[model samples]
Target: METKKGNFSNDNTMESIQKLTEQDAKTFLNLIYAILKDNEIPSEKLISQVLSVYEKKIPRLVKARQDNN
Candidate 1:
């Protein structure tokens, strides 16, 4: 993911979801969770954020993997 002028979108932020691999996804989630644990308290928003992060990380968890792995 290429960082833009402070915004995280478009060609900015992380690369498109298709670019992420399984280990990459797991690492991404771990990093986010680590940050959440260090800076934020447990809350619904936190949970939601975690889920959202997971949504990006493990796409298969949300949708069927066409590769059928």
Candidate 2:
């Protein structure tokens, strides 16, 4: 199921977070691309960093999302 208020999805996923507004997903993607290019990092390196980040942030994110719901 989905919720169409603005651009956000009610489901639990990164896509849902990105869908917070119509421009959210695009902005998130552009920001990631810009960071990768600016730091000269490979996609794999970015994935590694993302994993490291997820480890630290997923719990907080989950809580935040649940609170929002």
Candidate whose lDDT is highest: 1
| Cα-based TM-score, every candidate | 0.39, 0.37
Tell me the whole-model lDDT of each prediction, alpha carbons only: 0.55, 0.50
The positional error of residue 1 in candidate 1, measured at the CA in angstroms, is: 10
Candidate 1 Cα outliers beyond 4 Å, as residue runs: 1-8, 11-15, 40-69
lDDT of 2 by residue, 1-65 (tens): 22353222324446445434546446555655665666667778877655433332343454575
Clashing pairs in 1: 1-15
lDDT of 2: 0.50
Which regions of candidate 2 are displaced past 4 Å? 1-11, 14-18, 42-44, 50-69
- lDDT score, candidate 2, position 41: 74
